[model samples]
Target: MSATAISTDVYTQVQQFYARQMHALDACRFDEYAATFTEDGEFSHTPGRPAAHTRDGIARELRAFHEERFATEPVQRRHWFNMIHLIEAPDGSLRSTFYVLVVTSRPGERQPEIAPSCVVHDVLIRADGGLLNRSRRVEHDYLLDLKRT
Candidate 1:
């Protein structure tokens, strides 16, 4: 398969997938968020931290994020992705790269504030009639140099 320019329908499908996944996550529906991934999906965020593997592990990590970040505050989170680029792997999977901008705001706040922005690379495969993430790597802008010596 080649990395040719994708059709509008394909782009819209991928965009809708992200919309559902992010909404589930921000709504604190861990299982729904995990369902977006394959059973053996892997997710990595920080440079030094180990990647979380499997749907269960990914759900656990999301739970931890909610506890550590959201539990302490009254803020609601919204995740946005844009500038998507796609490539087709030889094995038939799709490689998707995009920028993620997360916004957070309290209930009484009049404005939302941006959280750390990130570039995410994901390997997506067709599973059970839809796209499922096989792997995801998130690189936060501020930590872009974290891997440098």
Candidate 2:
């Protein structure tokens, strides 16, 4: 195959990996979400929010927060990714930016509340089997509406 084709394939793989990651999160599959990262991967909502600098760190933080905050609540989250832009790095890795819209709803809610759509900047490292997310930075576009049910 040609070089361009190979690069396209790699990009597509990375995109699909990201899609699956979002799916896992939407499904509340936290373990799977944790598995999407590398051992020392980093996932951060923003600069001020707590950052998960490793797979174990992410799992710990997420599990603890979920247990404490939503122990008795039932909610669903859905993420939509769009405007994906990818570029091949010098070492054949991939760098990508995309826009994401997340909506959260409770079981009896009349309407799902949409979180501020954000731009995600990410670095994907190509590994032996596939691509792994080395880092992810999320930039929220608006202030969070914190009025709780």
Candidate 3:
């Protein structure tokens, strides 16, 4: 195959990985969600929020927050990723920026509200012919009270 074709294929695989990660998170499948990242992955959900520097750290932080949210409100969150811009970096990693819209609703609620639209910046590393997220930084459209949660 040509070089361009190989690059396109790699990009497609990374897109699929992103989709699967979102689905796993919505389903509360922690292990599956964590597997989408590299062993030394890093996640910063918001500017003032604490960042997780390892796969296990991400899992623990996400699980605790999500479990608490579910317990308090009984709401389900749906994540939508769109407008993905991907570029191959000089270091052979992929740099991506994507918009995310999360809709949250409780059971039997008539209207689902958008939780905060955000843009995610990611550095994806190719490993074993597959791409895994090395780092992700999320910038939200609205301000959050970091001290609360």
Candidate 4:
């Protein structure tokens, strides 16, 4: 009803969107993962990796990489998002930034290892009755640290 309440509700919806998206990715559900993005969504990483454009591009690229990783060694990747901050633009789109910790494990590892963490900035919008990511850029912590030294 109030402005703050509406903002909180929007943030909550985006949070829920992230929950579903991450779970789908963790489980290697390619279709589900792709659905989290817009049809023309683009995902890119800062420092090195090339961007993947479009929903199919995002899904295919990740699927190939993950499938190969599974084939070489059954590695399970779990993504944890934290410290999410959201800002709504006047045009009704949302900009969000969050920290991600990727935990990975394989057959004989004593414990899961924490892979290099990153800060992800995403442009999200409400579409097709739900929130979808329009663009995402990941800034790797190690890469940034390396630049300092």
Q: How big is the positional error of residue 96 in model 2, measured in Å on the Cα after superposition?
A: 0.7
Q: How accurate is candidate 4 locally (lDDT)?
A: 0.84
Q: Alpha-carbon error at 22 in model 4, in Å?
A: 0.5
Ranking by TM-score: 1, 4, 3, 2
lDDT of 2 by residue, 1-149 (tens): 11222466766787789789988877767778888888899888744558887888877777776677567988787888898888776676677889998888899888998876898988888776877888888888775565889
TM-score of each model, paired residue for residue: 0.90, 0.81, 0.86, 0.87
lDDT by residue (41-85, candidate 1, tens digit) is 999966666788999999998788678767868888888899999
Compare candidates 2 and 3 on TM-score and give the better one: 3
lDDT of 3 by residue, 5-95 (tens): 2367776787799888999989888778888899999988855559987888898988877766577678788999998888777677788
Query: In model 2, which runs have C-alpha deviations exceeding 4 angstroms?
Result: 1-7, 143-149
Number of clashes recorded per candidate: 0, 0, 0, 0
Clashing pairs in 1: none
RMSD of 1: 2.7
Report the Cα lDDT for residue 129, model 1: 73
